[model samples]
Each structure stands twice: as C-alpha cells, then as structure tokens.
Target chain A: MKVKPLADRVLIEPNPAEEKTAGGLFIPDTAKEKPLAGKVIAVGPGTSDVKMEVKVGDQVLYGKYAGTEITIDGKDLLIMKQGDILAII
Target chain B: MKVKPLADRVLIEPNPAEEKTAGGLFIPDTAKEKPLAGKVIAVGPGTSDVKMEVKVGDQVLYGKYAGTEITIDGKDLLIMKQGDILAII
Candidate 1:
C-alpha cells in the first residue's frame, strides 16, 4: 500500500549521501543536526495555517534528523512537517 | 521599546512554576522538557501560509525549552512560534 502523510507532513525519499563532495552543492549548517538532500515523494494537504510549498519530484534540503523514518513497500523514507524542509533546490 | 513577535511568533509572559501543586492543572509531559504555563502578551501578524490562532491575553501552555529567552525593559519573556504552544488554558 502507498503511504500518505497527514496534515502539514511530507513524504521524502532522501538522496544517497555524497561522500566528500566539493562543488555545486549548498550545505547549510543551521544547528547540531546535519543537512541532507532529498526528493519529495508526496506532500500532505496543508492545514489552514500552513501551505504546501514542495511538490512531488521537487529536490529539497532538510535537517538530517528532521523527520520520522518509516518503511513503505520495502523502501525507507521520511515523513516530516513542511516546516522541516530547509529549501527547495 | 516593546517587543513584537514577527511572522508566526508570539510573545509570552510565563506564569511562575507552581510549588508542586496537584489540582485543575493538566500537565503534559511530551518529552524530557517540562511544560510551562504563560500569558500571551502579543502575537505576530502571521505569514500568508500561517494564521495566528492564539491572541493576546490568552493563557497558554507550552514546552519549557521551546523558545528563545529574551530580556526586555528589565523584564524576562519568551518569543516562540504559535506551533510551540500546546494548548490554550
């Protein structure tokens, strides 16, 4: 079955972490948590106080530990609030 | 100068911690951090994506370490997003 995120949450498929990359990538360090890059797999219907900014197939940046990890269809993924996303790349 | 919270932020004047009391108080322990009670002193205009839910003079509950501590006009206060608030008391 396909997983669907609830209000203000988004389902993301993280890109494999690059090993010592050096160019064309913007890595922002906001706190102790590391930054990660990913692709949006699904998005929730945002609440009245929030709006969904990222759509499916959008490349995004988020905190490494920003979302909850879940397994769907034998694939690992993350479900987080839209606020957890740092930016759409 | 009086402080004004920006975006979805709210300014709160916290209630003093009770000296180990036990009635009419709903204490929610979501994590290691303790819950706190406070009065909403000011609220932001809210972003286009977020609508302000709490209003000035509203008594609210929130996590203890949820916001930044600031000293204004010789008085200490907290500034945090409306999302940090758990409920209105």
Candidate 2:
C-alpha cells in the first residue's frame, strides 16, 4: 500500500538498529531511547515556502522527538513534516 | 529558559503519562511504546502559505509518529511543524 502525506509531511519507515552491543543490546521496543533513523518512502509538497530537499529514496535522520507513528498495511511508519527532518544521508 | 521553533515548527514539552495500569506498568523509558501527548510552549510563524491554527498554550495531540526531541534548559522538548499536530486540545 502507498502512504502519502499532505503539505510538507513525510512518510517514513524506521530503519531498525543493525547491531547489538556487548553490554547487552538495547532494543527500541524495550529501550528508553527513541529511534532516530529511517528511510523516506513518500514526501509531501514542499512547505509552501521552503522547498524540500529530500526525495522518496533518501535515507534521513530525524530528531528523536520528531514525527508521529502510524501503522499502514501493518507496517509501522512515521508521518512528519519536512521541517522536522534534521538531515539527509 | 525558553525554546522556540522556526517556521511552522513547534516546541512542546511532553506530558508524561499520568497513570500506569496493568498486570504491571509499562514505562516509556522502558516500554517499546512511544509517548504522544504534550503541551505547546512555543510555536513558529505559520507556514508561509498556510496560517497555523495552533498557538502557544494550546494542549495538543500529535501523531505518535511526529516531532523531534531536543533538550533545552535541561528539559526535553519536541520540535515539529504545525502540520504534524493531529489535533489541538
């Protein structure tokens, strides 16, 4: 299924942490830390004034406090406005 | 101290869960669940094209997927654009 956001909002699929540390890994589903990385699956039209710099295939980093979580097609995804995006990778 | 967001962005201080119920309680700092409620402390100028409907002092409900987290004056704040706000309370 395709998810689209309106006016600067973005649809992101969080990238799960790739590694576990020796101290014993902290799982986001279990850890106090919020997840901060994801892949952009869809993006809204620019914020009306500021043009967005990310595209659908971009990998980005967002603030830990940014974005709203939603489940689409049973897949967890985040819906955040472009301005909340901190950086693109 | 105060934190101000830029251009349609909002600064919010999360309202911690008011109650915990269960066979046991789940702490956000421990649970896989994300925190979603907060009070608006500061708001940016509305998006250039769309005037924001929210203002500082509004109690809001955001998508569980929105906003970025930042610490200012030793307090945690979420930074998000107005569009990420799901509803105003």
Each model's DockQ score = 0.03, 0.06
TM-score quality measure for candidate 1: 0.46
lDDT comparing candidate 1 with the true structure: 0.72
Model 1, B36-55: lDDT tens per residue?
A: 78899888767796789999
Best by lDDT: 1
Off by over 4 Å in 1: A19-32, B1-46, B49-89
Please give the range of 10 consecutive residues that has the lowest summed lDDT in model 1 chain B: B17-26
Q: After superposition, how far is residue B72 of candidate 1 from its true place, in Å?
A: 37
Candidate 1 lDDT score at position B84: 92
